[model samples]
Target: MAKVLMKGNEAIGEAAVLAGCRYYFGYPITPQSELPAYLAKRLPEVDGVFVQAESEVAAINMVYGAGSAGARVMTSSSSPGISLKQEGISYIAGAEVPCLIVNVMRGGPGLGNIAPAQSDYWQSTRGGGHGDYRTIVLAPNSVQEMADMTITGFDLSDRFRNPVLLLSDGVLGQMMEPVNLPEPNDYDINSKKWALGYRGNDKNERNLCSSIFLDNDELEEHNWHLYQKYQVITDLFSKGEYKDFAVEEHLCDDAEIILVGYGIISRILKTVVEKCRKRGIKAGLIRPKVLWPFPTAVFERLAKTASQFLVVEMSCGQMVEDVKLSVDGKKPVFFFGRTGGTVPSDFEILNEVDKLVRPD
Candidate 1:
């Protein structure tokens, strides 16, 4: 493996190719446009397929079709674009197909600016569409993780026959960093017996990909089956009660206040944690690398020690909801955030934490 300097968005694109993704269907949107452009140029050289669909809807459907046919497929979109694709995402989930979705989120309730945001936390982890299904969601704070997680996401999706989300933002998408790209994964996706596209004789049972259950009882039964599948997924793949440290914790061993963040905001807060530690503030930080399976187990343990929690994000306060749920009110959780293209400075974060530590 060789280390090369690359923008985060380009790195994600490259990583997908390295992960054996041969089918890419996407629509162009800002901050992440470089990804599709990179793939458009690169995929051709590698004999991969790249299609610029008329819209996000068409693009996601194309991914569904390719994935159903046993192709390593992927798509990328921004927040608003992602919203439009949710219907197709639900369909993919229902069909039990393996495909990768990259959401380089930007600010938005609707058509929000091209600035980076963590606002899509609920949409990515919870339900982006109407269903009881789940998507394995990974949030990468650095360009290296952006590359590394792409390979992991593909593996996870294939392992469970479900969708996997690479949740990043505009900040990570455009930022540049040196990354050591791995060799194209030698994963044997063919080992998946359920995958479609078989040329075997009539003696072999055919593979079917569908989410449509017209009967009420059948739909309910299908949902329950999916639930059991999710449980098996949880049993085998989910990090256990003591195991959610999949989260990154910094200097929380004896801290009075713990700062919680993810993605770029979390990276920024690490420097803030160091600054606060220098001032003898005893500040800690929690960064969730996997947002869907969240780091609730870590929060339960930290709630007993830390005096308070401060959640910082690039949105008005999306992930904070999960933070509050995880803390379960054991400690007072406070939030400070900026949205719509506005990034908070280190001093701003420092001051916010100072307010939590200081008395009236």
Candidate 2:
């Protein structure tokens, strides 16, 4: 119908239903509690199922079970709760089950405060659980992207038969904005010939979903098969969704400095880049909508002309390492971060940018 104002968490919850999610299992946690809370009330209106599990561990297994049975399922939690779901997430990944997991990160190492933080960058992009598996991760910087990414997350997860993560921080989770919601998707989930119960009786075509291969050589073979699928997924879901690799940049043709940020942090950097440029400084901002694929092409392209790189995040420099890896010694990379519920303000970001451009 029409665009409407929505909170980020609520937008994601609503987007899941439109994306054809019928099962949602999650426990409540700060910064993201609204996600499950909204789903619990909104899902049934669409004839969907929402369960507030006893714990984060239980919630993820519930998602695993639903996904295995060929249902569009999802789960969400804050930082610590997300950690508790790692085992279940890895299990779902190994079993080749399609599901969605959302992390609205708060400050952490333990029970850190309730404000926004991107400290979970490494936890999300890296293998958080035991195994040689990878999960596709989408980082949304606004309430609208949060909603859009939720729909895309389910599609990618089902297409790859792997878990997809919508990674947001407390700011993006709690803020409000206007969004044009997507039309409800009528998915053909049962079309998967390999789904658990959809396989019509055939001795040769039994659907067996498991990660364990007792024999070493058999396990190696299975791993190789999974790796091949991952490459295909990288080509299909990741690159396909992000045709330009979803890297947003500005004023980079002659930019001497590159300021990289994502999620809510990038929102601030957008203005900083403009203001810096107005003051005769060639500063550009680069942001990634999909963090797992890491969008290295943007860095490689800018390396030819950019002299310095600066990464600003709410976390204590987790994504900076990725920036360095992307640059590959082509340029000097620096980082500015504020943790434990603190956000990098426009002034601070500008000051950091000035440090990189100033003469010694």
In candidate 2, what are the lDDT values of residues 78-130, reduced to their tens digit?
Answer: 99999999999899988899999999999898998898889998889886898
Query: Which residue runs does candidate 2 get wrong by more than 4 Å?
Result: 201-205, 236-241
How many backbone clashes does every candidate have? 0, 0
Candidate whose TM-score is highest: 2
lDDT of 1 by residue, 283-352 (tens): 9999888887777778888999999999998878888888899899899999999988887888999998
TM-score of 1: 0.95
Task: Estimate the TM-score of every prediction.
Answer: 0.95, 0.96
Model 1, stretches more than 4 Å misplaced? 187-189, 199-203, 234-245
Residue 250 C-alpha lDDT in model 2: 73
